[model samples]
Target: MSLAADLGIAFGRVAFVMLFVLNMGGLLTWVERKQSAIMQDRIGANRASILGLRLFGLFHPLADAIKMLTKEDFRPARADRVLFGLAPFVSVFFALTAFASIPFGDTLRVGGREIPLQAVTLNVGVLYVFAMLSLGVYGVMMAGWSSGNNFALLGGQRAAALMITAEVAIGASIMGVIMVYGSLNMMDIVRGQGALLWGWLPAWGIVTQPLAFVLFLTAGIAATKRIPFDMPEGESEIIGYFVEYSGMKFGMFAMADFLETVVIAGMTTSLFLGGWQVPYLDAAGVRLPWGWTWALPHLLVVLLQVGAFVLKVCAVIFFMMLIRWTLPRFRYDQAMRLGWLGLFPLSIANIVLTGLVLLLWGGRP
Candidate 1:
């Protein structure tokens, strides 16, 4: 194929990922509420109706989208109109863009076409994700500052500081997996896990880098600012950067949170769970009969991988929510102290241990 054609195909993959994630966000809305309800031992949000028929809050996400659309658009009288408008776009854009470097499946066969499941295979895919995540603080900071609300400014500042602390730990924790897998491309790291261990355990990031897994999970929760670490937008106190925002404007930030949930899940899949690589399936189960024939199994693998990825992410989200409902929210000082002093030291220790493990296993066949 021509170079232009190749580039087109790659961009098409990124578009496909965006569309796929949006649909997942729809389903995830239902799953998260339903699961959260179960965990809390109460029925949560199950009463939207279509001609007097209710579907267990399943239709509520649609209900939500419509409600957000119909709500009155509000802007603070003194708010910077342009920046107020731009903040949500900034949030949603980064939420959507970060997935480009990650693959959803192994490979597929179509009509004489062999398509790799990842959108763009860069050598620094994981590092690239971390960098994008760091930049996301701007969205919050801009929204809060532009709103001219003291509370919003405080919230945004808090979120920015927390993001910086969390990212260092998040990056440090994942470095262990990168060292073990020996690649930054999402697919390569996953494929590396296809190796067997005593016919029982697959060489997953969790099994090898257990310490990093904990650290990554911790940093991830803090980074996303779920309860216990949510000094940024303590929903109960309503100190979020969007304090001055309402209607569709505030909805945008909520949408970003939902989408970032997807991103974090994807990252979890890529870093620790072996991504789209299902365990024990040989590359033989998927054969590229024709150059284009790779599309079918490619689709299947992508579906399964994406499915597994979503599940892992949901599990984490559920756990996070459980903590939210089960545990009391941390005081802002405690939250900051935990992120900087606690996670920083623990992350450094994890890196050293991962290095020692690599040296010990370097001689393995």
Candidate 2:
């Protein structure tokens, strides 16, 4: 391909990914409010509407965007101006970029050209995601330290601690899946999972590595800093690392959190839920094992794969939101203990068991 062609493709993929992430982040604000309201038995975000059309509080996120844009961007009296300004951007940037390596679908063949459905297909896709997740902590630390407030600093310290504890478990938990798949590439892992088990069950990551699924989900939730693990931003206790931020600056921090949630959902879908892989649906169409066959057009097949992946990600995101409302916030000590003393050790044991199972089987999981 020519340089210009490559550049255009890169730009197109980047724009597509960013738009999806940003829209999902905005939508999740409404999801959070409505979800919590449903759980609490109260009306939520119904006041905002467009020309008398409420649309089930969908316009509330639009109203919020307008408000944030018009609101004054405030700073602390003694804050480090540069780092304070950069912190939220860093958080948002890493959160959005982390999804680049995740494969949303198998591939699209158009006019003799095969287009991979991911923004960037890195050989070390899992490691790249892990790196981005790790860097997200620097944003929290910077925001807290630069805010020139003791509470903000404490929140930053808490965030740092949470990341350290949770990441170890996250890494260990995913290690078993990586070993089972025998590849670090996200697409490779998904393709491997597309195979059938006993010519009937879809050999998904969840089926082959159930323990990793549980461990990864646990660690992933802690990494997001949501309810039951939100020590860093315990709204009732402290204003959090971005306590001094206001307007869109603060909005960026909030958006980062939501975007991170989406990333987690996508990762969980790709790693555990059969990403874009419909049961019995292949490049041609549905092929049953009982001598039955139904062929589908290539376009329809691609769409089905893409739709399946999106649906799975959305389901994961909804589950995460449900968890947010259902669970109570954990105390600092409790959260730490759960991470280090519980998840970490369990993840290690899971890896050992996985290794043993793989050794005995000596075949693809």
Encode model 1's per-residue lDDT on 126-160: one tens digit a residue: 98888778778889899989998888999899888
Query: What's the true lDDT of residue 290 in model 2?
Result: 84
Model 1's number of clashes is 17
Candidate 2 lDDT tens digits, 268-305 = 99888988899888898999878699999999998899
Best by lDDT: 2
Stretch of 10 with least lDDT, candidate 1? 287-296
Off by over 4 Å in 2: 1-6
lDDT of 2: 0.89
Deviation from native of the Cα of residue 67 in model 2, angstroms: 1.2
The TM-score values for the models, in the order shown, are: 0.89, 0.97
Task: Flag regions of model 1 displaced more than 4 Å.
Answer: 1-12, 286-303, 363-365
Q: What are the per-model numbers of colliding residue pairs?
A: 17, 0
